[model samples]
Target: MPIRIDRFENGPNDVLDLKAGTQPHIVLTFLATNNEQAFTQTEIHEATDIPRGSVGVVLSRLEDRGLVRHHGRYWAIGDDERLASYAAQQAASSASTTDDYYGESDE
Candidate 1:
């Protein structure tokens, strides 16, 4: 059950597919994992393997599309509850599959 990025499509403004240096993947992964948490550019740089210079551009693209918000020093996910809920459900399903296959639970 891998996390699939749905908002990103192979279109004109698909930053995920564009050559955004080496940070797009990092930003995507970070957003997918911590959509519920607010983070700063510095925090994103430290947490990810992305270059420091590319953080601003990547964040800007995400922000422009109403995907992320930059408030004070925190960059939070925008109003995309469906994506968050989908991720959570995928995680739960994966966990259940692992438990069932590993024979770790009785029922």
Candidate 2:
């Protein structure tokens, strides 16, 4: 059976569990890790192999969410804290989902 989404509550924030292997997750992780640098669409497409069109869409969403910034001809990370928080939330959700898949729960 498929496991229900694992979510956690932290005060006012409701964080949902997300699959970490998705293109968005991968791109987010990459951008976050290389926060000190910037890259153009072509460069990102080459490095991530995410297809040029998808790269543009991903960048648009991330920019709207304030997770990334567009500077001149390149894109760079916007908020490091949000990126870290998102990654952490995804990780926690994944862990619980794994435990559920194994019919185990950490009490």
Candidate 3:
């Protein structure tokens, strides 16, 4: 999902707010891609193209928002099994569509 930027101007003051930058989406993508494995900040940075410094901030925000949780030095998709299931279903649907469009089959 692309982030939507909202801009506001009030009496000569301009502010721009981003709707959850690539961080949350990236983290979810990484987790889904990794088969529910826990990932470290370094790994998230490498996989998601997010900076090391920013990963912590994003993870913290996600934690606060009840999206992800930290265990030691690694992060995992929090107790939200439904979200993980949904992501997996979406991924599978996308892959199936791609295969159908390309006339490819695992069988």
Most lDDT-accurate candidate: 2
Question: Taking the tens digit of each residue's C-alpha lDDT, what string does model 2 give over 1-107?
Answer: 55345533323252222357777666776776566688998988888889889988888877777778897889977766867776566566656766756775678
- Which has the higher lDDT value, candidate number 1 or candidate number 2? 2
Q: Which stretches of candidate 2 lie over 4 Å from their true place?
A: 1-18, 84-107
Go through the candidates in order and give the clash count of each: 0, 0, 0
> lDDT rank, highest first?
2, 3, 1
lDDT of 1 by residue, 4-107 (tens): 46533433555454343356545755665676788888889898867789888888887777667778888865667765774476457556866756765667
- The alpha-carbon lDDT assigned to residue 38 of candidate 3 equals 90
Candidate 3, position 98, lDDT: 66
| Residue-level lDDT tens digits of model 3 in 1-107 | 54334423223242222243566667766665565589899988998898889888878877776677788999877678776785687578668866756775679
Better of 1 and 3 by lDDT: 3
- Error (Å) of candidate 1 at residue 8 is 20
The reply for model 1, stretches above 4 Å from the true place, is 1-22, 86-107
